[model samples]
Target: MKKRFRILVTGSAGFIGHHLMLALQRAGHHTVGLDALNNYYDPKLKFRRLQEQGFNTEEIKYDTLLSNSTLHGSYFIQLDLADAPALQQLFKAQAFDIVINLAAQAGVRHSIDHPEQYVASNLVGFANILECCRRNRIKHLLFASSSSVYGLNQDIPFSTSHRTDEPISFYAATKKANEVMAHSYAHLYSLPITGLRFFTVYGPWGRPDMAYYIFSKAIVEGKPIRIFNYGDMLRDFTYVDDVVEGVMQLLDVKPATGKAPYKLYNIGNNQPEQLMEAVAILERLLQRKAKLDLHPIQPGDVRATFADVEDLALETGFKPQTSLREGLSKFIDWFKMYHKINEVHALQEG
Candidate 1:
């Protein structure tokens, strides 16, 4: 099979997007990256990632063809999925073989304060993507769904067959909606769609809003970290490399159809570790202790998350091998170098 083909990857400037694009490029695939470059967190960081990947930083604009260059014959266009006509035009121009949709308003807590963002990005934006794929007759579509869909299931290891109607947050609800929407398109139009329910993904170039990044930043700066749920939360923290690898494996593997080509799977570490356990690991990695301020769990927060990866293993040979300790160590090392933190004393005295 010729794995090297034109692939359209949304959220290409994001943490996972950046890593996934690099992986595809390394595997000799021609990729096209599209991102809104919104100031959701920091556009500078996004641009930096693009620059690191050999994209010309100076040419990039909010919504323009910043560059036509890449290390692996890749292309980039500054586009938003919400713009229906613009997205349609891009699909018309590129004729993408496969699409991996990773762009969405991401944080769970943020969704509580700003539910509209979720509706716009996760709902409407996703609809646009589906429309484009159908019109272009794309071979396959893969999207990023969250483990948050498990909501209050209280299941030990979340399975694909589990009932996911009880979503605790607006964010989780929107993700579940995306799954339903994708399944509908697959059944209606014969579009092969696969949705991956990702667990707590943390590593280098991660989102600033994520717990590991925020907590680590606070801990390093001697600020009191918000230890929510009295530090009783647990998560299946999966590493970035494992995530990209699993996604790469699915490039050639389209959703199989007995009746319709629609499938969903959970991609995560089978092990769930406590919030405090993760903090402790971070502390050990940074050589500094956290000034913990334990508090009650916030709204839209879950007590635990675990993933059942049997389906993923059976389909793609996906296995998460990085331990929390090892992942945390690599993250801390990158964090220090990225921020130019000289010493533990400097980190503490800051």
Candidate 2:
């Protein structure tokens, strides 16, 4: 029998974290979650996510203990990742066997305008996590990295072995910094660290800032949708469930200690989908046509992203296999139900 470990998942109220939270609890592993609930997009959705995890939003207070009775009394807390003292205290109190750092300042465009937020959250907050992990002697640490680190390399399928030195956006640069930083910590402290470079992850409970959510909303509400690069982009859009599956499998597979207890893998669908094609699928799902506003690609945007998941597959015998349409269909089903957009006009007015 596999040993069950106590796990801490940061960004637990976020899309990917929330999904992983449920999975961990169902698998009979004790899970603790932490989220800042910042208004990066909308705190309303974040609250709803917490509710889904069986936490009452009315009782939400910073640094306060919250747990879900329905999910085997799983613990959760509302706290910023940058709060070092709080994090350290939590680490010491919880005595977690595994820590997954999914909390970070997400969004490439937002990083351009608010670079300071990125620095505080990604850099400073991550340093705090590394310290706590080192001090607490946690067995393993896993962090969410992004494919944007590829930075328009023109490499057909981005591989883990490829150079990630040229990150085009501040967000990507920060993620690259995380990879190197984690490597150093793993080397110096002998910490087992695994980094996942997720592609365009999408599905239900997804971030509103992502293209899929934005386009879906626009199409549903009969508004114009902006298509960048004249909708000529390609993305290895990995579904949220698939990403979670990869993470779960990797949790049991630690890095071999020789040089450094560190490993990085590209967690993606390994299948690139066209931007316009995804839009078309959305239109079919929503039964509405989108008013297209074609524009040049924005700065910090890449033309295409393709992942080489050979290492991931070989290591874990798992690969992201969700088809774009199937994943989008599931997301649309949840989206419509979540937003109560059965009657589009009401959602538009509100």
Candidate 3:
């Protein structure tokens, strides 16, 4: 018999968070999703995601629990992690068996402009979560790290054992701080923690800021698409489904006792696809020719990213199975339907 656990997933309304929340609900787990739903890109999309989970966006109040109508086992709360008092109260009330902290101020370039946001959310918010888990006695703590943590490394495939001391971007630095912070909590409180360094994750319900999503929209609207580094970038684009699968697999599997029970792994597709090749695939799928706008590599942008998933596979016996072409096809289908590209030539014209 499978054990049905009470899970707390932070950032539940975000791209990966929404998918993960639905997946957990479907699997018969009592899950609670928490998100501030800040206007990083579009709050409407975040609200839409919450709405799909049976939350009425208009009625949602901060720090209040919103129950899912369709799935009795799911709930959502709109709150920031930095609110220590509220978070502590909720943690004490729920007594969650596991926590997956996916909430963070994402985007490297955005961090450059708004370093304060990263400090507030990624640092202070994360600290609050760690303290909550310690007081609540969470069985296992899993959080999202990033491939950006491997900043400036020329290594083909990034590994967990690699030295991530020198982070090029503020976003990456904050993530690295998360790993160390979790490790300290694990060491002191004897908490079981796992940090997953995710590569370029994309698929249906993807973030609009991502290159693939932007490129798709531009191509559909017959607008020029900017190719950074003159289309010389490489990325290990892991599909969202695959990332969820990896998370689900590692959910109940706690790190071995002793040594603070701290573990880290890279969750990504072992396959790295070239940027131009991916654009070509998008063009083919969308049936449109993209006007090429070549540009130099932007600050805080890495030339390439690949993942060494052998450690993850060895521990969990799981590897990402979705091919890039197949994943893009699914994304394109969703994009067209969701954005209503047929109704208008440009959804959000720049």
Best by lDDT: 3
**Whole-model Cα lDDT per candidate?**
0.87, 0.89, 0.89
Candidate 1: the clashing residue pairs are: none
Please, what are the lDDT tens digits per residue for candidate 2 over residues 1-350? 67788898999999999999988887888878898889998888888888888888677544444322223347778888788988888887777889999999899999999999999999999999999999999999999999999996877899998988888899999999999999999999999999999999999999999999999988877899999999999999999999999999999889999889999999999999999999999999888899999999999999999999999899999866789999999999888878777554346311
246 Cα displacement, candidate 1 (Å): 0.8
For residues 1-350, write the lDDT of model 1, one tens digit per residue: 55577889999999999999888888888888888888889787788788867788567543333222233477677888899988887777666788999999888988989999888888999999999999999999999999999998976889989999999999999999999999999999999999999999989888888899988988888899998899988899999999988898888888878667999988898899988989988888877789999999999998989999999899888999899999888888878877778854454211
Per-model TM values vs. the true structure: 0.94, 0.95, 0.95
* Candidate 3 residue-wise lDDT, 1-350, digit = tens: 57988899999999999999988988899888999989999888888788888878677544444222223377788899999998888887777899999999999999999999999999999999999999989999999999999998877788888889889999999999999999999999899999989899999888999999999988987889999999999999999999999999999888877878999989999899999999999999988889999999999999999999998899889878899999999998888877876645556421
Q: Rank the candidates by lDDT, best first.
A: 3, 2, 1
lDDT of 2 at 59: 71
Per-residue lDDT for 221 in model 1? 86
Q: How well does candidate 2 score on lDDT at residue 214?
A: 95
Answer with 2 or 3, whichever has the higher lDDT: 3
Compared with the true structure, model 1 gives a TM-score of: 0.94
Report the lDDT of model 3 for residue 339: 82
Which consecutive 10 residues in model 1 have the weakest lDDT in total? 62-71
